[model samples]
Target: MPDSASDVFDIPADVLQRETARIFRGHGLLPNDADWVAEALVEADLRGIHSHGVTRVPIYTERLARGLFNPRPNVCVVRQGPSVVSVDGDNGMGAVVGRRAVAAAVDVVAETGCAAVGVRNSNHFGIAALYAEQLVAHGFIALVCSNAPPTMAPHGGRSALFGTNPLAFGVPAPGERQILADMATSIVARGKIILAQQRGEEIPLGWALDPDGRPTKDAATALNGVVLPFGGAKGSAIALLVDILAAVMTGAGFGTDLPDFYNDLDRPGNLGHFLLAIDPARFGERDRFLERLGRYINMIGDCPPAEGFERVQLPGEVEAGLRRKHLSSGVPLSQDILLGLRQAAGHADVSLEL
Candidate 1:
């Protein structure tokens, strides 16, 4: 088993993916679903988003082993109208259900030029960018968002009433980087707090408040308390919009109805997500759109930065760059996380090879 005194393990991406899949498969997941979960987790790690990566495998598999979610869901889809499609996830893993939803939207948009797919009864799907990036890869503009478990306080309120409520968008740019952005409506995601706690670091003030409505720097206190909204009322308002579309409109649990992912081990999350896609070809030629996007990227890069900043960067640039670097060197995971994952795998007699 891994220990803190050891150097951080640098596992090959492919090896980590297979090990993750093997552990999930041992826990009664289908081969395809196991693979999907593994790949999604590895991708998040590769992109340097440790909060959404393999660090989550222990909690996920624990819930799965305890019968919190369906290992194999009979996901169903219904066409609401010419441009609307409804998906029932049947309590499936978020990544697996999300892939099915995006695939359905792609099929519908091919004929309708645009489509909206609403999803319900899913678990935390890792990262929203993973879903939106699919549309960008297929030459379509996509918007994706999800409602999480309640952790953020509404504007001017002391009690937590909303999830971080993330929003993600991806637009295709032929010659330029993909316009992919995934952000939380709060000052920071709940994941960041979890990460800080794991690393034993204090958080910056204004990021979160204690349970009694006092600003806090302690990560653990913030997790038990409330995460603050980004721009006071504005971010809270956006979180509300996301909750409405991704949960209320999708016929899934909203606000107080959702279960706590960290503590609740035997109950399904009943999470929901929403996806909207538009084919650029419908508005104009694909080549023209790509070229225009490249122009805008160049124009923005040419601007002068303020004294404290270096150069301008787009939304997806940093993560994309990190991915390229990690792919060659392997992903660095802390000994604590590696040991936890090892313990989880060991229970199933799965060899992690970390």
Candidate 2:
């Protein structure tokens, strides 16, 4: 462990994944389930998405231990049609439920060329890109979205009533150059503020408002308050759409109906997710679609960068570059996060040096 919480540790990705898996297993997750969740979390760290990465381990394990989320879930399929499926996550961790839903979609798309999956009774699923990329790898265009516990107010409201709903999209292009876009409707995810609070750091001025509805830069104040939407009303509208599709349509909690994941340890997080997969082969020739998408990708890549920017890059290009660099250099994690991971590991009698 580092001498100070501010110190940074660059641990190997595989090592972190293995240790995290062990920690989760110690918390009662089955071996395969533990591995899957650990891999997704570490992959997010590899891509520089720390807010959705292993920093979440402490809360996740705590929730599991407290029975706030089911460590072992049945993940039953409630309904299915030719191309649409509805899943009941059985109050499991969202990462596990989301993967199971994606697997069902992949199986269906293999025969139907398209599949829409709605998942309810789930917990937080980390990041939507985790599932979107899975479909993209299977030669499908993917759109994935999820509704979280309300942390943002509606467009003009003051009290928290809308979630920082997130959406992710992915399309296979050429080689390892596929397009993957993931973002929250909020100015920033609440997890970022939570992380800032954990690190004793201040947030940017515009990220959130205090409980009094005044904009605040204090992380703790922001957590007690509400986060702002990304593009004002536009972002709010997108969030509404996500809630409708992911929560309302999926029979999950929405708006004030959902329990906050961090504060509401007494209740399960009844989150929801919507996953759609479309096979290019269904529209026409898969190769032809890829060729056209390749041309489109080239067109975007050729665009000149504006001032203050280095170059034009696709949606996931920056993160992909970061992943390539970090894979060998190791993943940079703050000692604060390391401390939390250490405590979590100790609970399971697992010793982690990093």
Best by TM-score: 2
lDDT of 1 by residue, 1-354 (tens): 345534586888888889889988887789999999888899999999888999999998888888887889999999999999999999999988999999999999999999999999998998899999998788889999999999999999978889998899999876646678989999998988998998889999999999899999999999989999999999999999999999999998988888889896757898999999999989888888878888998898898998997988888888998888888889988888787788889878887776
Model 2, residue 264: C-alpha shift (Å): 1.3
Q: In model 2, where do residues sit more than 4 Å from their true spots?
A: none
List the candidate 1 regions with Cα displacement exceeding 4 Å.
Answer: 1-7
- Per-model TM against the reference: 0.97, 0.97
Assess each prediction's global lDDT (C-alpha) against the native. 0.90, 0.91
Candidate 2 lDDT, 9-116, residue by residue in tens = 799999999989999999999999999899889999999989989999999999988899899999997547899999999999888999999999999999999999
lDDT of 2 at 313: 84
TM-score of 2: 0.97
What would the TM-score be for candidate 1 when compared with the true structure?
Answer: 0.97
- Cα displacement (angstroms), candidate 2, residue 55, comes to 1.3
